[model samples]
Target chain A: MKYFRYKEEKIFRVLMLVSTLFIVLALAIIIFSILYKGLPMLSWEMISQTPKGGFYLGKEGGILNAIIGSFYLSVCSTLLALFVSLPLALFMNIYLKRYKFVLNTVRFFLDLLWGVPSIVYGAFGFIIMIHFGLRASLLAGIITVTLFIIPIMVRAMDEVFKTVPVGLYEASLSLGSTRSETAYRVFLRQCYPGIITAVLLAFGRGIGDAASVLFTTGFTDHIPVSLMQPTATLPLAIFFQLGAPIAEVQERAYAAAAILTFFILIISILARLSSGKFQRNKINF
Target chain B: MMLQNREIRRLRDRLNVSWMIVILAIVLFLPLLLGLGLFVQSGLLLKELSIWNVLFTSQWMPMSGKFGLLSFILSSLMVTVLSLLIACPVCLLTAIHLTQYAKRYVLNIMHPVIDILAGIPSVIYGVWGILAVVPLVSKYIAPLFGVQTSGYTLLAGAIVLAIMIIPFILNILIEVFRSIPTELTEASLALGATRWQTIKFVILRKGFPGIISALGLGISRAFGETIAVLMVVGNVAKIPTGIFQPGYPLPALIANNYGEMMSIPMYQSALMFSALVLFVIVMLFNLASRIAITKFETK
Candidate 1:
């Protein structure tokens, strides 16, 4: 029986090793396939020029409109989310510090929101837009994406703030600092690295999301100059291009995907670096 | 001067309290508001089709006024369950290895890979599925099984989703396993139990509730995943007879039809109803996970 159990342990260990290797293999395949298909099609014009007529028929064009639009949408939404999330994080860690029940309930709901599918947010956003007589414009997309990322930003920032020592708050208060003052001056300064990491995380989420903006952001070929105008995003660009019957257009989809992946990789690396810095700065008390 | 200072402090406190209330209110109530909005929007469909008929019937003809969602519901279930089946054992084993057996260098390489996996967007997975998984399955796996498909089947979606969800489940399980006391494992080992037995009877038992919650979270994620599943699933509005057959899930249904819903009568409402269904199902799973995690933590 002992020998049998030992053999079982060895077999299970091999199984675990295989599974781990499988995950790594999958990731490598995804990256390799994207680069192999995308690089040959990727060109300076593809990144600089807008699609012309019959672009979906493999006509000459670029995804510049989507590149610009994704940047605008993600940047605007990330900043908006930060404005709301920062104050909320401060409030939770400072003013409502004693109300553990309320804090947990809030965190629970935020988790639920985080878990919600982006497509449902699209539906909800569509309903709200219709009620307000709003069109599917950049503003609508920004709002929808903002709603999508607020929970993420707030939760991440909240976790960072939780790591802060209680004594620091008490010390500031004893030094005659107002709660608002201390939250803004002391806590915010201490957690800024974490806050930056959270922002990057939210930005990555915002830029990559296609479902939440599917209906809310009406697609267009031009870079949106006004918030009221429809904007194209990279994910949607990839989706539309991939759906084309033409093979060249499908290759363009690969190029678009490669661009998207590159953007996310950079953001992930930045987030990791900032988080490492955040850990170094974290108060140990 | 002292009185004036105290009054200023009082004013600041009041202002802070109000700000807290406002922020908390928005943070807590926005999701409920979104849920309520979806519910109200779906009322149009409820008015048109009896909720029972909408849920139970198999035929879904938007043009001819049939609005059944049973097939979509079933397809979603099949794909989610299949993906969970594919992912759970592998992720569980990987998590066990990470926490128990892997050396530091192995962990150093593995941790970043999992982190990178977690950060890859769903759309990239969709493109990868279309580029890689589809052809491989169609050309290789399907033929081996004598199942003919274009490769865009429920199985393809499940495979993509399983890969997508591995990091999500593994991350949670690793945390749970790490939290288990080391003494428990040592005690079992001292009793002359093999490592497998210790892991099975000691670590797994202690982490059982967390594992359940992790799976619950995985289910919620798999069920609600959109772009990747939509890209791979063949999007035929029918209950799949086999994993090799093409089928449409609810999220895919909404995504494929939402743009043209205005042209068909009651179509928009039906889409809204589908969104509501997805929302409720995901919310229930999320709540279950929260409850499970909380229960385990408190214990």
Candidate 2:
């Protein structure tokens, strides 16, 4: 009986091991397939050169415009979200403790906002922008992306701000600091890493978003230097052109997808590292 | 004189308040105001909207007079259900293995990859789906069902959607299993219950709420997904004939039509109507999930 039980235990462990292996295998397949199909065309000309009339991979058509537009849109949305969500975080920390009803309602709405589909936000943006006569412009896309980014940012920032030891706040006040001073000087300093994480996450969300931008940004072959003009980001480009039967266009989309994936991977890694560093920094302090 | 000065200071301190009110008003109230303002501005368009005729009817042709949300709603539900059917079991089992079985070092190495999965974009999922999963499914899976095998179908979209949501489900379930009190497991083991038996009886029961939340969020996510489904679901603006037929989800319909609608407010309003419908469904599911989880916690 003892030998049989041992065998059963070994088999169970091995089965669990195999299950874990399957997940790793899935990740490997995603990364390897993308790289295998995309890396061959990622040359210098592909990075810096301008698109010549039409799509060409391993030639003059670099994703310079798409990259620039993605950078611009991401920067705008992230900054807007940060501006809005950080203050909300600070307010949640500062007041609303006794106002449980209002506080809970706000919390619920924020959660709902976070969970609302990005595509819905796109529709909302489309209607509002069209009414304003900004049809398919970069401004519309930025606004759409902002709505999607804000809720998550607020949630992350709120969690981080709450975890900031209350003693830090009390101590600052006892040392003759004003409420604003204490918030900025002490609470902000402690929660900076979490804020950075929120920003990075929003940035990741912004760059890779396709559904929200489909109607808002419209489609343009040329990169626009101005925020008012329509522009194409990597995700939009990938979505629009990935289905192309032309081998060259499809190849360009693949390379662009790889670039987008690489960008996301870097942001996610940075978020983890910064958060980890913050924990260590706090421990040391 | 000194005593008089202290009294004055106390009175002044009692009367003066912090500017916390200003901060709260700016952060919380401003957005609410904006949302309200936008709603009011769009009220003209919404005034022409009828909840019954727009939402309940099954004909969605903005070009013609008929507008039916049935196909879009059905398609969204089909994708959500099928994707969850594929992902939930895998995720739950994976979570079980990770939380209940894996060594600490193994968990550490594996967790980041899961995070990477969550970080991957929907558009890339679309790209990958179109290139790989759709082709494989069209070739091997669809012909068995007597439907024309193409890269774009409900099955292909569901498969990609399942892959996209598995990480989310896994993340939640891991948290759920982690929260199961260790004493319950210990007590079960002391009574001669095997590990699998203990898991089946105790762990699964305790983690049921988390599991529900995981599935809820996963379904909500897959339902809301647009780009991936749009790219692969063959954009046929009709009801799917089977699991293999082409379909158009509500969000996808909104996406494919929103920019093209210029001649009519009805068209834009129809898109808004779809958005509102999607939003309400998502919000309802989220609220239900939260309430269920809370009830479970109380029990």
True contacts kept of each: 0.79, 0.53
A1-285 in candidate 2: lDDT tens per residue? 866766776676676677678778777788777877888867776668657765643335777778888888889999987777776777677555457677766776677677778887776677668668786778889998998888888887887877877677778779876665566667788777888988898889888888888778876767786778998788877766676677778888888888988999899999989987765335223
Every candidate's DockQ is 0.73, 0.44
- In model 2, the clashing pairs are B59-B68, B60-B68
Task: Judging by lDDT against the true structure, name the best candidate.
Answer: 1
lDDT of 1 by residue, A1-285 (tens): 777887898899999999999999999999899988998899998999999897888888899999999999999999999888998889889877898998788888888998999999999889988889999999999999999999989998999899888899999999988888888888998887889988998999999999999989999999999999999999999998899988999999999999999999899889878867755545666
Worst 10 residues of 2 chain A by lDDT: A276-285
| Candidate 1 clash figure, as a count | 0
Clashes of each: 0, 2
What interface Cα RMSD is found for model 1? Answer: 1.6
- Span of 10 residues, lowest total lDDT, candidate 2 chain B: B12-21
lDDT value, residue B191 of candidate 2 = 100
Assess every candidate by TM-score: 0.96, 0.88
All candidates: interface RMSD: 1.6, 4.5
lDDT string, candidate 2, B165-203, tens digits: 888778878877887789999999999978877887899
Chain B superposition TM-score per model: 0.94, 0.86
The top-ranked prediction according to TM-score is: 1
